[model samples]
Target: MARIIHRLYNERAFRRERVIRDRSNPLDIYNDEELIERFRFCRRDLFELIEELTPDLEFVSDRNAALPPSLQLLIALRFYANGAFQNTVGDMVCVHRSTACRVIRRVSLALSRRLARYVHLPNEAEAAAMKQQFRQASGIHGIVGCIDGTHVQIQAPSENEYLYVNRKGYHSVNVQIACDANYKIINLVARWPGSTHDSRILRESALLQDFEEGRCNGLLLGDSGYPLKRWLMTPLVAPTTDQERRYNTIHSATRSVVERCIGVLKRRFYCLHGEMRMHPERVCTVIAACTVLHNICISKRIPLPRHHQPLPVPEEDVRPRPAVGIEDIAGRLVRAQIINQL
Candidate 1:
């Protein structure tokens, strides 16, 4: 009898904790600003996302009524916008913490259904315009995008843990991102371990095939950590002449587009900025989902969250001797042409 009474008391408390004071949706209590503040998206965009992900999120389960697609998206977005613990975010919506964790995974993989739509290489029409913009902005001709690798911090994995330790002495994933001048993520490669060199990631990527096979035209501006290909240009190791100095200046300005793109991406979704607690495979999916959403936010002209701004991209290598790109003869000729023009 005493144990039964104790159990009843705990059940009542749990029921009260799950109940919202006055609203059906906890989201209704917040204004548009608060909605954006908490979820990084207004109701309209959130609803659209809900509609797109509804099919993917639909299911038959005991938790169905409690975990609708919209609410699941809300929970996931809240997690992404603020890298708080699962239980903490779960508390905001009155769901159990375990439910929140499952919802985050579900919503993340659901978003994956639309991944290829938003993130893609520029088409023929986009390439011409992008090249013109790159030329006008930095006087760097025929440049369509900038490529760079940024380390997304992650919790130490149980398997092959040493592979994830980057040069910074932290476990991370080295994500390669290429973006057009308009701060759009045109291409991304997110599966490499942090210990892998940025140049190696590019070397093994299909993006190189795009350039090599003529599927994608226009030059790419990358840092010294990437090899200098005929279609990819890197900064000079040492600039002696005025022309070489001018080339490096313009190259950096052009490359800063991708850097700022990364800054905006991590700023919009704080999950990428901090140590994500999920498995690496799931974390990569979340990163892909974030990139898709990042492109959407850019397209919709959504304002950045307060205090969110582009970060200065740090160098990948901080050792006594920084790594430089492997020089290619044809690439050198192409880079010289641009410098001479400058």
Candidate 2:
């Protein structure tokens, strides 16, 4: 009886010593507009996100006082919104720095897992509508999407650190984004290192393969860094004639859709606006997850921040690559045909 009583007392003491951090409602401190300002998600949108992510984020066991899924999301969003230190951001919700880091990764991964649902190539009907929209908006016919690559800065990694260094003389991951006329990201490829060229990133992507096989309809407009494939159009490097110059101007303007999408993405998620201190792998995951969230915000018509954060460094590095390989004759013919039509 004495030993059992002692064990019970020890158990009670241990329970008392364990800490359960307080989770406050951000809505209490910040009104709807203020909350959106801080976290970039209005309350209604936030609740919708929380509901969507709860199934993946909620813990099965309540051990050690697991964070409420809503709190977990808020903590992650705060990190994403401002790119502040983990501890500093976590303190807003009374979680440890480590806990905040883990939560950010968790929430990022959760969103990334659902990336296919949010980001994807347009289907048959969707593609037809997108083609018309692109033509109407840019005066460039048959443009289904615009593509570009942006370098996301990151802390030096443990393995192959040299490969992460970009021409801007910094560490980063080169993320390729493809967006439609409306600045909505349709597809994203985020796994490549910063040293990888924009053309190579496209050359090796399944997106290119799908286009090669004629799986998706319409041409994709890209900057000169990409090859002028039959399905991918690049502006003429030397346009001697007025019509050629006009085509170049139109191509540049049409391709700027992807650039604007990148701008809005970084503007919305400041974490991508600056260097991310996580590992390269985590950085990739975070980028993809952010892309997914960016699409959601675009669909819901979330207002872009009034102040534009500086866009990512110019990616059309050093004009066209020196070794662009043999030009695709078929691609040249396509451009010429479009030029005549124009």
Candidate 3:
């Protein structure tokens, strides 16, 4: 009888604690400014978005004391902002490690569904406007978007891990991103392993098909790693003439936008800056989530984090090629036409 009475008392205490925690406002812990600094979004805005996608009701039973939607969003944002482990993030928000993991997965999945609304491939009219903006910034005509690939480091996978090892002697995901002048991600393809070549990723992408079908107008600027195609423009192998040198200079500067975007992205989300310890598939979802968040930050005009800085792009290696090929001829003819206008 004493034991039963004790159990009843403990249950009541636990219920009381849940009531207090749920009623407690997170704003008391951190003001709007502090909340924005801690997580990238202001408290009001973040709560509204989370509330829209996730109902206010607890995901788990009230007995389990599931986290509020606001706390769930906060925990996930802190994870993305710092790339800290589950335990560390949980401690920050007063939750267990396992609960932290569940919260992050749930929030990531939720945000990823809204990716289409945030990140999109430009339509014909949008592409024209983007190209015009690029021309105004730099006198490069027929340029639609800049294309490049960055290696997102990841832990060795369980199966055929060797395939994930890149030339840099590390496991990574080779992510291809296409951005316009405003650094908005027009298209993103990130399913390939690190060992995969940048050119291969592009060739396998739907964007390549669009170019081939002439559905995508204008040219895409890429670095030496990609092949010279009718739609894709790469720098000259050896620019002997003054005009060729000027063209290469302009091409390098214009293409640097994609590199800059990659830098900004990694800096904003530190998870991509170093090796991420997660399954390959989960890593892909996280990468997509970060991309969507990056776009949201841009759309909302949110200021970058205080310590944010871009990562430096590595230098490219030289590659041998055929003296003369059909693709080479086509690339040169297109270049010659652009140079004449210059």
Task: Give the Cα lDDT of each candidate.
Answer: 0.86, 0.86, 0.80
- Candidate 2 clashing pairs, residues 3+ apart or interchain: none
Report residue 237 deviation for candidate 3 (angstroms): 1.3
The better candidate by lDDT, 1 or 3, is 1
TM-score of 1: 0.90
Candidate 2 lDDT at 148 equals: 86
TM-scores, all candidates, are 0.90, 0.91, 0.86
Task: Name the top TM-score candidate.
Answer: 2
| Model 2: per-residue Cα lDDT at residue 125 | 90
TM-score order of candidates, top first: 2, 1, 3
Error of 2 at 307 (Å): 3.6
Candidate 1: misplaced stretches above 4 Å?
1-24, 61-64, 313-326
By the TM-score metric, which is better: model 2 or model 3?
Answer: 2
Write candidate 2's Cα lDDT for 1-342 as tens digits. 999999999999878565677777796788777877888888899999999999999999988888889999999888888899999998998888999999999999999999999999999998888999988876777889998888999999999999999988999999989999878898899998999888888878889888989889889998877888888888888788888899988888778778878888988889998989989999999898888888998899988655646375454443655325666899989999988877
lDDT of 1 by residue, 1-342 (tens): 999999999998778554432214746778878788788888888889889898888776745355777788888999999889999988877787888899999998877767789989999999999999999988877889999888999999999999999988999999999999889998888899899998889878889899999999999998888888899998887889999998888888778778889999988899889999978898898999899989999999998877777677765442223335557899989998988899
Q: How large is the C-alpha RMSD of every model relative to the true structure? A: 3.7, 4.0, 4.6
